[model samples]
Target: MTERKPRKDAVRNREAVLAAADVLFTRCESPADVTMADIATAAGVGKGTLFRAFGDRTGLIRALYAARLEPVREAIEEGPPPLGPATPPLERVPALLDAVLCFKLDNRHLALALEGNGSDSPYRAEHYERWHTLLHDMLERIPGLTDSAFTAHALLAAVRADLVEHLAGHEGLPREEMRGHLASFAAALLGTRPRGG
Candidate 1:
């Protein structure tokens, strides 16, 4: 028995839907404002096609978010330091957190939508687990750093989308300043810098 491939039209429609949805999400103030019907209309497809291409709104959002994150994931997974695996744990840990912060900053609205979608805890997200595990392992490599697991969670929480949005969007903190603050905070924990320096 041979596996059947998706029809050409189906492939085309799926691409159109994803492209349309990406544009809609990028322009919308809130993810909730971009409905499946809106995406279907924008993509020039029927509602049924939209649902068929992506199971539901959450599924679509997750897909879009994952697509946007692909480059960052690749850099972290294989590209050069300090995000790549070859970097020392001490240097890589802060770089990892910084990269995460910048990603949230760049994708503020989408990050907020996905993490605050209310379907479930952001902690349950696969990306969250990947990041947490990476950070945990890095933290464990630091000498005298007990509670690496809890420390990793704490570090990640500090950069949570909502908190970042609050600080950057609401409180009006500058991006570089926020990054500096996070780097300094992490440095203290790693004992690489003086506290509050």
Candidate 2:
């Protein structure tokens, strides 16, 4: 059977809720500071609507994050070289890491909301597994690289949401500087010269 589409009102409500939650997450000092009730209030929707649409707080955050991450996913999966599959592994690996770092930097609040939910380890999240698997596969393709799994995990650790917040928020590292550092780190790991160096 064909899948049924949601009602127009349902679609509108979901967008409103997501927008409201985005604002709340962006402004709050901590993800825990923004609650479902706050989101419902900001969206002008009832609590039941949110629960029905998202299941729980974690569900809502994941949905929001996935929505925000769609472009990155598309680029990596099918777009042109560097991020796309057509690029060589050595180039693509650092490009992939750069993309992830940029995304986390751009969506620091939302990222923290999803990764710092405290209900479960972020490593177990579907998104994390996808990234790990992608990175592992790419790392394996690069000659002289060993322990692709551990290496992927280690590289990803540099861009973790908490660490991003600590660097960008607390340490006040400039965004370009952070990206530069990450690029250098990736280059060192891949036995490459840092970009523009």
Candidate 3:
């Protein structure tokens, strides 16, 4: 079925609301403290319009997070992946590492969490679950693993908050060096390496 076109004013109103929310999220320290009226006033829209545009604060957060995740999604689909029928599983390791770094850089909240060593929460655990699922699906050929899911979880643990802080902060290693070394270490364990960094 053909999609009906939305009216111009309706589109403008939604854009205004999202723009306002973006500003608030970037400027505010704690997202939980921000209110609907705060968003409405910032956007120059009515409180009712803010509520109508984004049902509630939770809906707003979900939309905000999803918007941030979009580029990461596109990067995964088109920027890097296994890449070829001939590209070995180990070759994908660096791509995976790079992807995770990109995601962390893109999300300010996530970056803050990383800085604060806040990777142990239930919220972060959910991200690990999704990351592990994706890794298991992509690195299916890694040997010594009857269970790829279990291995993925282990790998994520290796790169978790404190570990990452040690690697990038305390250890004084360059981010690219850490990525290459970690990918190589994993690839060595996997027994197959991808050709490119």
Candidate 2 Cα outliers beyond 4 Å, as residue runs: none
Clashes per candidate (backbone, < 3 Å):
0, 0, 3
- Name the weakest run of 10 consecutive residues (lDDT summed) in model 1: 188-197
| Reference-based lDDT, each prediction | 0.87, 0.94, 0.62
Q: What are the TM-scores, per candidate, against the unseen true structure? A: 0.91, 0.97, 0.63
Question: Candidate 3: where are CA atoms >4 Å away?
Answer: 1-4, 80-87, 110-130, 156-197
Tens-digit lDDT string for candidate 3 (153-179): 666655665466556657787777766
Better of 2 and 3 by TM-score: 2
Estimate, for each residue in 99-128, the C-alpha lDDT of model 2 and write its tens digit: 999999889999998898889989999999
Model 2, residue 85: distance off in Å is 0.9
Pairs with backbone N, CA or C atoms under 3 Å apart (clashes), candidate 3: 90-194, 91-193, 91-194
**Winner on lDDT (1 vs 3):** 1
- Runs in model 1 with CA error above 4 Å? 1-3, 194-197
| Residue 164 miss distance in model 3 (angstroms) | 7.4
Expressed as tens digits, the lDDT of each residue in 1-197 for candidate 1 is 99999999999998888789888877887767888899899999999987777788888778888988898899999989989999989889888899999999988877887888898889989889999999998888878899999899989998999999899989999999999999998887787862245
